[model samples]
Target: METPGNEERRPPTVPEGIPLLDEEAKLPQNERPELLIITGMSGAGRSRTAAALEDLDWYVVDNLPPRMLAALARMMTPGEGGVHRLAAVVDVRSREFFAELVSVLDQLRLQGTDYRIVFLDADDDVLVRRYESVRRPHPLQGDGRLLDGITEERQLLAHLRRRADVLIDTTDLSVHDLARKVREVVAGESDRPLRLTVVSFGFKYGLPLDADHVVDVRFLTNPYWVSELRHLTGTDEPVRDYVLGQRGATEFADRYVDALAPVLDGYIDELKPFVTIAVGCTGGKHRSVAMAEAIAQRLRDRGQSVRTLHRDLGRE
Candidate 1:
C-alpha cells in the first residue's frame, strides 16, 4: 500500500535538455503512461515477456528502434487513441543501432519522462539449450559459433542489466512463470485493473510461479489412475463429466469462484494489474486442466479476461 501523500510524489521535473519540435511540445498528454523498455538476450523470453505485457493491457511494440523512443512515448500518451500503458522491445535485433539505446534513455531522463527498464536474462547453458531446442540462431550470431556471440552480447549488456529496475533470470522460468513475474512487478506500481492468469499444473513438475493462489484438485479425483481415462485429456467430455460428477465438484467450483469473486473484484477495482490462480492435480493433463478451463470460462462469463495455461500437459 502507498503511504499517505505518496500519490503527490513525482520525479523531479526537468526541462527537456534536448530541443523538441513544436508539434512534439504540443502533443496532448495525461498521467505519463508507464513505459516499459524491454531489452534482453535472444531466446531469453523477450517475445513472451512482451505478450504478457500486452495481456496486462499494455501497448507493446516489438523490435522498436531506440531513436524512436521519444516519438513512440508521445504517441502513446493518454487520449492519443486511448493508449495508456506502453511496452517496447529493443534488442540486438537492432544491430549496431542498439548501441545508441542507452543514450536515448538518458535523453528521456533529461526530459523528465517516467519509465522503467526490465532486462530478462538466462544462464548461458540454459539459453544455449533453449536455442538448441528451438533450432534457431541467436540475433547476434554470425558465421561463428553462437556461444561466442552470446558471450559478447552479455558483455555489451552488462551495464544495462545493472541499471534495469527489474532483472528476470529466465533460467528456471517457463514462459508463464516469466509472465507472472512481469505481472507482479507491473501490478505493484498502482491500483489498476489486473489480468487473471489461470494456470493448471501437475504436482509432478511442482507449482507454477504465475499462481498468486493455488488450489489443489488432487483431492477431487485421479483420472490418471482410472484405466479407461488414462490416455484422455481433461478436456475430454468423459473426464470433465466424471470429475464434475464428484460429490463436491460443482459445489466446490461454485464456492471457490464465489469466494474469489469479491477479492478479485476488489483488486481489479483498485487497478491492481494481474492475478494468477493455479489449479493442480496429480498430472496436469487431467483434473487440473479441466478445472482451469471451467474456472476460466466462469470468469470470462463474469466479464474478466483470462489466460489459461496447462503446464506439463504435453510433457512425457
Candidate 2:
C-alpha cells in the first residue's frame, strides 16, 4: 500500500465545535466580537478563506470543537487583544462532533450572539483535482475511490449547506478572487481598501450580473431619437452636453447621490469593502453612459476610488 505525505500526517479524530461562552460574561463589555463560522467543502478554499479573515484582523481559531465555542469566546477581553471580531474554521473530520454543530448554533442564538456562516463550494472535478494535486485522501474516505469520498462528503455537508448564510462557489475563482470575495463579504472591518464599481449597461442587454444597486437612466430623453446625435456616443462632447442638459438629468444625478450617501456610510460603518452600482439606459450608448460618468464623478468627489465599467459600450 502506498501512502501520501499528507494522508500520513492527517489526524483521524475531529474536534467538537462550539461558539464562545455567555455564562462567564454576563456583564456587558465595551467591545463585543462579531463571530464568523467558516466551514465548507474540504479542498474548496476554507484555509484560504480563513487566511483572508486573519489578514482582515479577525481573531481566528482553526479546528475547534462545537462544544467549545462558548467557552473560548468568554476568555477574550476586547481591548486587551484587538479582538472586536472572531472567526472559527471547522471541518467534518470528526463525525461524532460534527453532529453537535446544529445544537451549538441554537445555543449561540439563544444567548444573542451575532454569528454568520460562510460556506465554500466548488465543482466535483475541481475538488478532485485539488485533492489529487495535494495527494491527500478525503477526510471521510474510510475505504473507497477518491470520488466516492467526495460524494459522501457532499452528502454529509448538505444540511450545513442549506443553513449557510453566505455561500461562495470557487469553481473558477483564483486565490486572489477568493480573498477578495471574503473581504467584500466581511467589509475588512479591521481596515482595508474600499472597492467601488460603477457599471454602465443597456436595459435591452439585460442587467449587470453583479450589481448591488441599479440606477435606471432610461427615463431620460434618448439621444438616439435626435438625428444629429444618433451617430454620436455619450463620450462625445455634443452627446454629453445634450444628455446632461435634459429636463431631469442633473436632478436625478444629484438626488441619487444624495440618497446613496447614507447607504455608503452604512457600508463603511459595517466594514464592507465593495459595492457595485449599475446605471442603465435603453441602448447603453448615450444617455446611460453620460449619466454613469456623472455619478462616478460624484462618487470620486466623496473620496471613493471608483472603477467605471461600460458593459455594453461597444456592443452597440
Candidate 3:
C-alpha cells in the first residue's frame, strides 16, 4: 500500500509471496530473472543505452522511481508476468523518489532479488557540449550554471558509481560504440574487441561528428580534374586505381597505419570499443573514398574489425 511520495516517511512493504532477502539468495543465479538498473549522469547516454537494451529484447521503463523496483521485479518472473529481462532507467528526474534508491536497493538485496546496476558517466566538458547541443537544461540545474548541476549530480551519484556492477564512461564513445558496449556487457563478454569505422567525407560538408581521427586526402592529386574519373565514383576501378596511384597515396596510407599501431593498441588496452577514422577530401567523391577503402583494407589486413561509410559520396 506504500505510495511514491511516502517512501521517505516509511519503508516499502513487500507483498505476500515475494521471497524475502534470505530466501531469495538461495535460488540459483540462472533461476532468478534479470533486472538491470540503468542510472548515471544526465547527459551520459542513458537513453541511448536503454534504447539499445530494448533492441536486444529487454523491457525498458524510463524515469521509473526506485520505490517501484520491487513491484516491477515481481513482474520480471519468467512465468508470473512473462518478462524475463527488465531494464529500468532511474535517475534524479524522479526528484524525491530518487532519494530512496539506496535504501530500496539494499532492501532488494536483503529480500534476495538479484539485480545489476550500470552507471554511465562522461567528462564535464563533453556533458556540457551535449547539453548545449540538445538545448536542454540539466534536471538539477535550477537557475545555476550547467556545471553546477553536473557537480551536484556527481556528488549524489558517487556512492552508486562505486556500487555499480558496470561503469561506462561515454566521453569518447559515439552512440553506436555505446550500443556495442552495452551489448557486450549484457552478453557478459569481458574481452571486448575494438571496432573501427572509417568514414569518407567532403571537407566542404564538414567533419563527421563521431570521428575519433581525421585524415585529409585533399593533399593528393584531385581526380576530379580527370574528365573520365570525374564521372565515376571511388567504387569504380578506374577511379580507385587513379586515386591510389597518386604519388604519395600508398606511402601515406602505410605510414599512417603504422603510426596508428600504438594508438589502436592503446585503445584496445583501455577497453575502448570503437574508433572512427574520417577520410576527407574537397568533394568526398574520389580521393577520400579511395583512401578510406585503402585504409580499411590495411586495418583488415592487420586483423582489425573495420567498416567503411561513404558520407556525401553522391552529393555532387
Show the colliding residue pairs in model 3: 20-111, 21-110, 21-111, 21-112
lDDT of 3 by residue, 166-255 (tens): 999999999978887888876454454578999999999999999999998888888899987889888789999998887888999999
Could you tell me the lDDT of residue 99 within candidate 2?
80
| Model 3 C-alpha lDDT versus the unseen true structure | 0.89
Better of 1 and 3 by TM-score: 1
Give a tens-digit lDDT track for model 2, residues 30-103: 46667888888989999998888876767899888888887766655566566667888877865679888888
- lDDT for 290 in candidate 1 is 88
lDDT of 2 at 48: 91
Instruction: Go through the candidates in order and give each one's C-alpha lDDT.
Output: 0.83, 0.83, 0.89
lDDT winner among the candidates?
A: 3
Instruction: Sort every candidate by TM-score, greatest first.
Output: 1, 3, 2
- Over 4 Å off, model 3: 1-31, 79-81, 189-316
Query: Which structure is stronger by TM-score: 1 or 2?
Result: 1
For residue 305, give model 3's deviation from the true position in Å.
Answer: 23
User: What are the models' TM-scores?
Assistant: 0.54, 0.51, 0.52
Better of 1 and 3 by lDDT: 3
